[model samples]
Target: MHLSEMTPEVDTHTHTVLSGHAWSTLTENCLAAKRRGMKGLCLTEHAPAIEGGAPSFIPHSQQMLPDTVEGIRVYRGIEANILDHENHLDVPPEYLRLCEWAIASIHSHMFPEKAKKTENTETYLAMLRDPYIDILGHADDPSVPCDFEALAEEASRQGKLLELNNNSTTAHRPGSLPSLKEYILCCKRRRQRVCVASDAHFHAMVGNVRPLMTLLEELDFPPELIVNLTQEGFEGYLRERITRLKNLH
Candidate 1:
């Protein structure tokens, strides 16, 4: 099947107003996702480390939302920040443990040793080892380059997902196309699982993953390697991740 013919069932990365820079509310995001034919959306507000983002209690607070909103599932989750190369995340383990889905990212100005690719790669490689982090958010930013091959291998070994962030590949991170393409190629080479995300900060952008899909179509990336490509597939991955997490504890 052509990549154009299939839509990712879930918008695995998105944000609401709880994430300071975002412009929409949870209700708005869910409605948009549903309108765009998505079966679910991950409510991945930034963790406390973000200057004007959600508090650490976000995970506990997310439980207040219903399992489905505006007729589509809204997975309670957090986009936790990778604090250092020591596998440390800004949000504490207790709260992270409460999240249904979690994304670990290195935001601009927030990551130390920023321009150092070696250190950056080490940081991401370490984050993948965290059981609670389901995906690594937006590693395509050119300012923070890392080893995509290492990341893909690590995520595959751990059965985790790497993100193909639409915003980063398109508008958010300029000069990122080449790097993002490289990242995708590495995932394809390793046959690692990935999640195609809008990384939408607004309601209108929810489930808008066309640009990345176009790239995948061009590369002939395997749809099976993308966890959220179908609702059943996405749910199955979540179940498997849950079982794996359970084994860890």
Candidate 2:
């Protein structure tokens, strides 16, 4: 599907006011997504990895969110921080269970430079093996330094989606495009699916996929393999994911 033909670019990874560092409120984020013609936006706040950063282990109360926003579904989710050596997140299983979806990712602050590249890949692979994880956000980030082929294969095997993070490509981390491209190619070769995320920290950044789209074109990626192209297909994928996660518990 061409970018113009793609309806409702669903941003599966986004941060809201709940994320201590994010600048936008839930309402503002939703409004921004609406303006961008997004069918839905998942508010994935940071699962704290550092001290005094939204409390590393506490989960947000889901009852605090409105069920819907401007006719678009607002999924309560979190970008759970991947700790070193272990695939453990700061938030507990009960907290993760409250979310409609969950994205596991490696943030620079969480994984220090001294960490082993192979061990980092192992951590991600273990997370992918876990049925609770729906998506692996920004798995190709060079700072974390993981083997792209292995991660992509595990994602394909487990039916978990890989993320093409646009923000990381643009400015968050420079010189990582090669790694991201490798992930894209690996996913393509493995016949795995992926989602393009803005990984937005503010409202204006919500639903922005220009960077990711351009990269996909440059890589000659198949649009049909991305999950956000159609609502029916996306939901079907989500349903299967939920069932898989539930069975794990």
lDDT of 1 by residue, 1-249 (tens): 689666788989888988898999989988887787889998888888888887555566678888999899988888888887676888887787888888999987887677989989988888888787888999878889888888888888888889999986665788889988888898888898889999899999898888889899999898888889888888898897689778987
Clash number for every model? Answer: 0, 0
Q: Worst 10-residue stretch by lDDT in candidate 1? A: 54-63
Cα lDDT of model 2 by residue, 1-249, tens digit: 566334345778888766788889888888998887777888788877754456553445666767778766787788888776766777677777767788988777657742578888888899988777888888787777888888878888888888888876787778888888888889888878988888888999888877778778777787889887666667778788788766876
Superposed Cα deviation of residue 89, candidate 2 (Å): 1.2
Residue 32 alpha-carbon offset, candidate 1, angstroms:
1.0
Who wins the lDDT comparison?
A: 1
Relative to the true structure, how large is the alpha-carbon lDDT of every model? 0.85, 0.78
